[model samples]
Target chain A: MFKTTIFTLAIMAPLVSACGASYAPPTQRLADAQSAERSAAELGANSVPNAQLSMKLAQEQIAQAQKAMKDGDNLRADSLLIRAKADAELAIAQAREKGAKIEGEKAVDDSAAQKATNVGQGATK
Target chain B: MNTLRNLGLLCAFTTAAGLVGCAANIPPQDLVTARSNYERASKGPAQELDPADVHAAREQLDVAEAAFAKDGDTQATRDQAYVAARKAEFAEVRARTLQANQTKDRVVAGMHADERKAVALTSAELAQTKGQLATQGVVLQAQAATLATEKQRREEAEKRAAQAAADLAKFATVKQETRGMVITLSGSVLFASAKWDLLPAAQMKLNEVAAALTKEDPTSKMVVEGHTDSQGAASYNQDLSQHRAQVVRDYLVTRGIASDRITAQGFGPTRSIADNASPEGRANNRRVEIVVTPAATP
Candidate 1:
């Protein structure tokens, strides 16, 4: 009875974990209407998105894969492991980009008025 | 068939011999108690099962009891009953634990679903607030732009007023005072000696200057500064200078400029632009200087 049940369960489990994974670097860009409204108040759009949520999602997927293995679903577990690792790497890339965006925005906000004044005065020329 | 019969005969003879020998540790008289006290070593500390776990748990106890009293060797049968008892105990506990874990897992899963729902609702509300903020941001940006433009217009008007002043003067005398702007007018024209009263002609000229200031910016934020020559004691001159500047400001207020925007200050010979040694330079220093300060662009 144990052998029969184990074999049948293994066969059934393959269908659950068998997946066609698609990859996309998800980005949230503000629409023109939203940007216009934001510009009225902050004089700028929300340039930084929540990158940590993505990292957490990737980490969660990795945990789910580990759980599948412990639940005696190795074939499904193996497939999830690959996708989870890829997502984690994607999250790292997003983190780097987010940091760069923050630095870039600070640079823009700091020098905006001074640069505008200097250009008007013809000091550089 | 003959070999089977001989083997069976050997087993019977052995049992009969064992019945004649030692039989000390048979289970107690209570059938229900014996079953209830079955060894539960295999399942460890997990909960024991309900009566529903096995269909024949009680029936098996009765069967073992009957065998202990009739035909079978008491000691051998008792050992067999105890082994079965341990297995029943383990299975009962194991079944109960499995059922409890399933129930707990279901409750946890339900809570997770509820949390997910709450998160989705919060996300939608956040998106809406962000949208409103974005709209408000656009309006603020436009208002700020209008303010910037107004500041630029006022600055241009000031430049034009300065050019007009230069045009009005047949000989434009532009002197950079060390302290600030100091315009010199004769004492006879401004006030009578030993008296604080301003002359009618001098009041008219000062009004014209104030009108010119109004032309520079309708919002004429200015300071009326008065100075005195070192002809008297420090305290007297300070008081006299302050009185004169206040007089000038009051006259300007009557002319049209708002009182809130203008400030009257008196520097009584403390700050001298030219040497007090010469009469002409002292006269220049003694003059009432209207210092025009620029407002913030914001």
Candidate 2:
């Protein structure tokens, strides 16, 4: 009787272990992606209107490209994405020249930064 | 030794037979009673109890009773007396459990009655508070309406001030103490394709904007925005939009817009005036944009 019970438990152990291991990667990836996306989005959102506008455009392009791929237009999607990327780079450069910061805590151009600060202060326009 | 072993075997056999007789008499009735109790308990305020207890007790008792019944015993025998003892013990347990359950029910009932009265009193108080709050709200709303009127008046004044500033912007050959003007340009003026090159007409228009920006102030700033339709990858759009914006920036530079104060940016299809479904919409979706706002005092 003891031997039979031991045999059953041993068989069950591997199954339980396998079930526990399945959720690791996706959970970690989701957390990392969420944190990174939020900071980047915040920085982009409060940039100078022009730079913010530019970033918004680039983001839209990226979305369209992703949509294209979803619709099975891989080549067109790639082309669209590439263009969007270029646009973002140029936008970033211009924003920086206009005294917009690109990479730091709350990194966005000056006018945009002010807009963000104003929003926090309840300035709506 | 044989007598001793036989005596042990007889004890075991008699015990087993006694168990059988007890189960045959008690189990079915007990099952009905226990199930009724559990179902009633489930329906009662005690419904929050873990059902596992009832389930485990019922299952264990039923199985043990069944196993004993299969062993068998006669009603009018010593074995029967032993069976009675066992059954009595289980019945005592059931009675005790029921008594405890009754006491618990009584206590809970009293608690619920008190709670209901408390809740009713609280509700009455809340209603009174709400009535007072409603009156206050009416007064506040009237004040808010007046304040809204005042806010609209203030906004109108600000609008006029901003407009005057804009008009002054049109005439200025130079502006000082302004860090830069944040200009969000419309997508309608800049691109013909995925390419970011400026059209001839667009260049002319840009030159006009730059000329205004060149102001006599000699310290003006300019930022050009490039926008695109949502039609491609994010990275690609960002880069392409940026390139197109830069192209406009280069054009502004050639047109004598100050390199230091001038900046261009590309926003790939992030902002859209029209949907991306039709040709007209797409055309509207693609373009250079600018936003003109007073720069910082620097």
Q: Which candidate wins on TM-score?
A: 1
- Model 1 segments more than 4 A misplaced: A1-125, B1-33, B38-53, B66-80, B99-143, B170-210, B215-298
lDDT of each: 0.57, 0.56
Write down the lDDT that model 2 would get. 0.56
lDDT of 1 by residue, B254-281 (tens): 8887788788988888878788889886
lDDT of 1 by residue, A1-125 (tens): 99999999899777665532322211111122223222322412123243344345445655665576567555445544443443343344344444444554554444555445544643322
Instruction: List each model's interface RMSD.
Output: 24.1, 35.1
Instruction: Please give, for every candidate in the order listed, the TM-score of chain B alone compared with the true chain B.
Output: 0.42, 0.36
Quote the positional error of residue A84 for candidate 2 in Å: 99
Candidate 2: tens digits of C-alpha lDDT, residues B129-198:
9999999999999999999999999797777656544654452222332344444444555556666667
Docking category of candidate 2: incorrect
